[model samples]
Structures are given as C-alpha cells and as structure tokens.
Target: MTTSRLEDLDEANLSPAQKVIYDQILSGPRGIVEGPLRVWLKSPKLADKAQALGAFCRYDTNLPPRLSELAIITTGAVWRAGFEWAVHAPIAIKAGVSPQIAEAIRLGQEPQFEAEDEAAVYAFSRELHENRGVSDATYQRCVAALGEEVTVELVGILGYYTFISMTINAFHVPLPAGASDPFPAK
Candidate 1:
C-alpha cells in the first residue's frame, strides 16, 4: 500500500478544534473526512471556511449538476490531480456527462461535448485554468448559456477545485484504496 504524503489523523488523535471541524464535515453531505480536507485539518479555521465554500460549490451551485461536475473534472485534469479526477469522474457520469468526455480530459485531450452547456462549461473552465482568464468571446458565451449568476458560480467551482487540486498535489494525498492514479505521469 502506498503511504500518504502527510499524516492521516484519526478521530482518536484529533485536537479539540480539529475534532470540531471533522465533526462538521462528517455531518455534511460529504459524510466523510477525506481528500484535501484531510490536509486542511492541519488548520482548523481554514478547513471550516473552505469546507463551507466547497459545500456550496459542490451541492448548492446554480449550475446544473452535469455542468458543475464537468467543471470539476476539467480542473482536476488540468492540474493532473488524481484524487480530484477520481472522485469527480464518476459523479460527472452519474450526472449525465459522457464517459468519453471525461476520458478525453483524463488523457489531456479536448472532449467532444454533445450538449452546448457542457461545451460552454468546458471551454470556460479550460480557458480559465490554462490561461489564468477566459477570453471575452468564451466569457460571453458562458454568460449567455449559463447566465451571470451561474457563470459566477462556475468560477467559484473552478477556483474551489483548483484549491483542492493544489492541496492534494501539495500534500501528496493518496488515492482511495484499490484505486490507481487516473492521471499518471507521462
């Protein structure tokens, strides 16, 4: 078994503040403490705030589930964040994203989107991740397709996942048991 890059704290070992945040995560939709949150536990206050933001982006975003998950895997693939990709790829498919589309992103190729909204989300997210900003045309297309509110939430999802991806990468968080890295080194 591969070892985690950081210590994986268990309930028995948690400080009072860490236990509070851990309990909060347990009670949320996540219902488990894993992924970047494991690393975030090192800083309880940061974990609390970030998890709140993440809860909104993951569950309460204005974007449809399909588009939201599309944005998530896009960010994961861009960063080659194995944990993020592994966690979201299945959710994307369950939410109606084609497996082919997710596989294309996994292989670092552009996906062929059958839905215009999916295509728009992909373009908007990919551009923002790769270029640090989206072009006016892409931005306008996203705004037109998703509207200003969801477009903003799309940005939030992208940013939140970026933080998650970076945390996983930085901490060398291990993949779930029996799961291989979806984005292996070239």
Candidate 2:
C-alpha cells in the first residue's frame, strides 16, 4: 500500500499505544507518514525507536544536509511510502538537490549526474540501500566524494530508513488515496 491514501486509515481512533507513538511523530516539524501508520504497527516502543532513529540519522549525523535528505527520500521512494517521499523530496530539493536528481530517485532510475561528485552521492545512496551497506569499492568512492565522517552519516541514514520502511511496511499501514505502491503483487 502507498502512504498517500487516507480512506483505509484508522483516523478517528488510535490505541493508547498508537497514541503515544503518534504523539511523538506529530510533535516534529514535519512527519507525514509516521503518525497514522504507528497505530497499525502495534508496537509503540518500536515505533518511537524508529522515529527517534530517523531524526538522529537525518539531522544529528555528520552528513551534509543535502546528502542526508537524498538518502532519506530515496529510501522512501524505494519503500513506496508516498507520504515519506512526498515530504522529504521537497526538503532535499530546497537543500540544493536538482530536480533531475529528485525525479530519478522518485522513478527508481539512476540520475545522469554529470559531475563525478554528484554521481558519487547518488551512487552512494543507491549502493547503500541495495547492498544494505557500502561495498569496499563503494565505500572508497564515497570517501573520495564525501570523506569519512560524511560516509558514516550516509550509511547511518540508509540503515535508519531501512528500519522505518520495514516498520511502515510490516504493519500494512494504509496509503493515501491514489498513491501508487512501487512494490505490488508479483
């Protein structure tokens, strides 16, 4: 299910557990997908951990804003979280990411990033998500582009998003209406 649909949601009521999880998400500046889905997760502690981990990964990590945002929204797109993609895409764009780059991530295609640096950033996000971590070669490429501290941040971003995406998925949270799930029945 996509995160854009509201029709299938448990909007009117939430379990006490779900409420706590929802509260944590809503307290943030912008958290589009986390609230409604927390109810479906049926595990408040896990939900909170996901949210906190996401925040720390996105902001507290040493990654530059643009790189972290790219990693996050790409993760969202891969996971088919309409809400996550919708919310974070613009954040990345505003943080200096090009529209082409954002479009590529949304479409599940690799962007033709002319500059080696930009290509490295995109590849790092892709490889990290694909391999669940950077390979030795990919890590070296990432370090060449981003250096060690930022490389660590990039990996953390990927890991955190993976956790959130899986959480959003396993609970079968309802997607907003008209939103497409990138992954559908085989």
Candidate 3:
C-alpha cells in the first residue's frame, strides 16, 4: 500500500460519531456484515431504501452474476467510493470478471470483449457510470441483446451500487488491510 493510502487508513483520526458506531458494530455479532449496514442505517430513508435495493441485487431473477457485477463495479468506479470499490470488485471477479477486466474497472479503463453481448454490458455500464444515465444507443443495444427485464435489472443494479457508493463515501469505511482488497492499487 502507498504511504498516502496508509495515511488514509489511520483510524486514530476517525470522527467521534464514526468511532462510536464502529466500536459498537465491531463488537456486535456478525460484525463483518453488520458494520457496513449499520453505517448506512444512519438515516431511516436510506436504510429502508438500501434494504429494498439489497434484496433486488440478491434476488433479481434476470440479471446474471457477471452482468450484475459489471453494473456494480462500474458504479464503484464512477463514485470513487473507495470502500465500495474496495469490497465488490472481488465479488465481480468471483462472478467471472476476469482479472484483466477487473483491473480495467479499478483503473477506470474500458473492458475489451469480442462478443456483442459482452460489449453491451461493458458499454452500458460504462455509459451509466460516466453519464449518470445510459445512452439511448446503449440502451437499445442492451435491450436488443439482453431484453427489457435484464436491462431494467442492470439499471437497478447500478442504482443499488450508486446508493452503496454514496453511503460508503459519506462515512468513510476504510478498506480492510491485507485481505484481498477489491480495488487493488493501480
């Protein structure tokens, strides 16, 4: 890790409110899972929205894992939500985002693919991330390739990740050290 990133992880400087909740969650049962959600639950509005969004991510039928992860990591890159990128990039990889592809995502680079379907995911996700909305051309291509249900799920997946990005950025969850960090250094 860079000295600068190490400086960022120095927990000694955590805000007082953050420190309090961090300790409570870290001491709770299943701290690893609870920690992130606990931080997001600060606002009732956000918590309810996150719960519904999370269910959609987990249970949505039409979105295959690869495409879902594409939308997720793309939002992570756009938001530069260090912790969001730090967490889900590996899940994307596990769901079949190639190391090369995952690295490209981390560095804000475009994915390379020969298949039109793959290109649609790459293009659609990139467009959604870069523009805060999908381009009509990209949308049409995605719909033609993957159909409307999947296209909607893809957009919803992006919305979910965008929500996560905002929450993680606001409270500043430091990525875990020494584990497989999702957004590995460029």
* Candidate 3: residue 97 Cα off by (Å): 1.3
Q: Can you write out model 2's per-residue Cα lDDT over 31-70, one digit (the tens) per residue?
A: 5544334543456677677677766887688767777787
Any idea what lDDT model 2 has? 0.69
Candidates 1 and 2 compared by lDDT, better number? 1
Candidate 3 local lDDT, 17-91, one digit each (tens): 555545554554424543246565454355545665676675564877777776777788877766676667788
The best-first sequence of candidates by lDDT reads 1, 2, 3
Cα lDDT for residue 118, model 2?
63
Instruction: Please list the residue runs of candidate 2 whose C-alpha ends up more than 4 Å from where it truly belongs after superposition.
Output: 2-21, 31-41, 114-117, 176-186
Off by over 4 Å in 3: 1-35, 177-186
Tens-digit lDDT string for candidate 1 (105-155)? 999898887888999999999999889999999999999999999999999
lDDT of 2 at 108: 81
**lDDT, each prediction:** 0.91, 0.69, 0.68
Please give the distance, in angstroms, between residue 131's alpha carbon in candidate 1 and its true position after superposition: 0.7
